[model samples]
Target: MTVYQLPVEVTAFARWLTELAGRLRPDAGWYGVFAARDPEGLRACFDGAEILPWDVVESLLQDAGEPADGPLADRARALYAAAATAHDRRPGGAGALAERRDLMERERRYAESRARELGERLRAATGEAEAAGLENDLAWVRDDHARAAARVTELTTRLARVEGHARAEPVPAAQAEPAAAPARTQTPVRTPAPPAPARPARARPRGARYAWLEESAEERAPVAVPVLPTGGAAPRGARFGGGGDSAEAGGPARVAEAADPAEAARAAANAVYALQRLRAQGRSGEAHVLLCEALNGPPDRLPALAAELHRAGLGADWSTLLWEAASLPPGRLAAVAGVLADAGRAADCDQLLRQGVARPVEELAGACAALHAEAHHREAHALLTAFVRVRAPEDAARLAGADPRGLVPQLLDAARAVSATRERDLLHALRVAGLAGA
Candidate 1:
């Protein structure tokens, strides 16, 4: 039929499709073309609506009324008979049908296989992120973007090479000159050899006293605290091994040898510092692994040491590991919330915040705002509300009055809500407490 002769409904469908094409994905485009109202679109259609085979039509009828069971089980018996006859007439008809069935089965199997492969890769990547100290959820997203960009670059290069090869004109037999060259008279047309393989990169060597983080903490490094002699005398080092001259000499220490407690503590502290450096560099997973290695066993003051590690940016890893280790008790919620907030795992951070704020009442308003901007509003609200109630009650009250929607507004409102006298008193009390303790 001529273009103008088409029905109005068909014309509208065509225009709707033309507009939709810009937004529709490639996988879904085929179906769109199948239902197009234009002449060109109609020509390109699958034409399978009335071509349902006998078995499919019968199945369709048998499964009718359950639309999701699919059209295969909903067609009439007469439609099946027509399909059966048409299907039987095609070249190698029965064989082709069998082949098609096999192909579909194989495709499904391959799809399942690919899904399993992806799952494995995701799990491994997650482990690597944990190991490498990527405790923050945002870090995972950043890494994912980086990896995807690299893949795109690699694919683009490969495509360029393929296109170059495809467009190159071939030399015809009449123009070819290879056979014309004389074996003895001519220097051999030598082809350049492929480049040699690059040598494997070497790993960094570990020192004898490498400070390790706890596996449970997933910390990048051990916390190191410096200690000076309480006696106010500059001793070269402390004596171990029954506090005798033999211990102070630092010679071949015997089985009964014991390290100076202060020296050991210093070593642990230094290890923690190194771990802090790694965490700053976005290698928290490696830092955590290293920290565990350094400690070698349960240290006496782990929680305090962990707090120090958290200060070093290994907190996110520490919190994640701790929660996993202790059956995720309520007490650890506050710590986990803090770490997750830093790592920018806003969604997970929100969940942890909900669990944490009930007891400790430490609200992560900043975290809530961040996640909210990222479209995790439900979580952000939960976190921000809880945070205001616990850490900044005045601010929370102000927020409650203003009903601020965003991060800064929420923060400001919360601040304004607090009474000036109360704020001054709280600050003074904290300062005095620090002074008295010191």
Candidate 2:
């Protein structure tokens, strides 16, 4: 059935129930009757009502294409009977208690089934890694099962208490009344209030930059440094020395000023590498600090740093870094796109390339050529076609010369799709110039 039809069916069933209850008992509203909390109150309502059996209710629900059995069916029957009883001003009695027991039983059975499935998976787990992953799932399932079992026990006890209460003999009306009390008076006593405890001194603010200094001695201890395995190249930002920007120029000065520059740089590289490994291992909190440090280090180097993070499987941070470095230089953007494409992020690479097309035609052509060389022909083709379509005819004529894969035929096809115009004439001219079908 379609999604829209299901709600209509449910509404129809509810309306039918309301009308049926009104016909049976006109004084009480359906909701007022069903909303009774106590078994005695509900039983009072059901006293003279002719309630339908569970099977009848189930068949009715099935006819309406709704679930006909289990907790849902029990609850539906309980509500219908309660509404009728409330209208008739009769007791609901044992009906409410019976529905509660059925609901709890169904819940317990579902929980047990879930626990069994999880236990089977846990038993079949092959190694420490697999077992560790399933540990939380198994624990949750077992806990739910235990709670369901405990609830079932509690419900059973309550059901017995309710049954016993129902079977008990009624007290005599005269005996149920309380005896008259004698009048008396007494003076009130005064008491003192307790004093509040004094507040302690406030500590200094510990910012993220110096958070390491606040760590305990054991946490601050030196550890073995990890090197990137053979075939895993360090990201561009990990390089120690560089030229061009002010950050690169000051790198040497910063290193020279440090007592142990080599060690410091090595530590930084190690930290970056470690963060990458931690992210791969799903230790996000530990990696977050290092990610912040890398991001806040140098604006010029952020893109390359982000590219490395992306390669290292820190996708969430990589996306943040990309947004931060959105206005990067054309060359840097192209480089970042290459890194993303190499890391199997073709969509990101294509997006970055589209942004790079806003640069000069020569730069755009070079980027397109690189994209083609990297076997991203589809992206390259789309980028060039969009560039031509948006540019003026004269501008497009100049840009078309740089089209490595002759897109002139595609342009002609586009031209034919539109009404004849100057743009179409320009495309025809370009086609005759051997650039269209090349």
lDDT tens digits, residues 302-378, model 1?
Answer: 34445555666655445433322211222122233333444455544544553333221112322332244344455
- Model 1, poorest ten-residue lDDT window? 233-242
Those runs of model 2 whose alpha carbons end farther than 4 Å from true positions after fitting are 1-335, 385-394, 403-438
Q: Using lDDT, give the best candidate's number.
A: 2
Candidate 1, TM-score vs. the true structure?
0.19
Residues 1-438 of candidate 2: C-alpha lDDT, one tens digit per residue: 643222322333355454444444333333333334233533332342233323334444554445532334433533443333232222454566457657755765676777778778889999998888788877766655544444444344334434444334344555454464566433222222365565554453343333223233333222111121221121111111111232222211111111243433443445557766764553443454455444223222333444555665655556434432222332233344554555566756554443333334544544444445446565566555444443335544555565525544444444444436845776666765656555
* Candidate 2 global lDDT: 0.43
lDDT of 1 at 307: 52
The model with the greatest TM-score is 2
What are the TM-scores, per candidate, against the unseen true structure?
0.19, 0.26
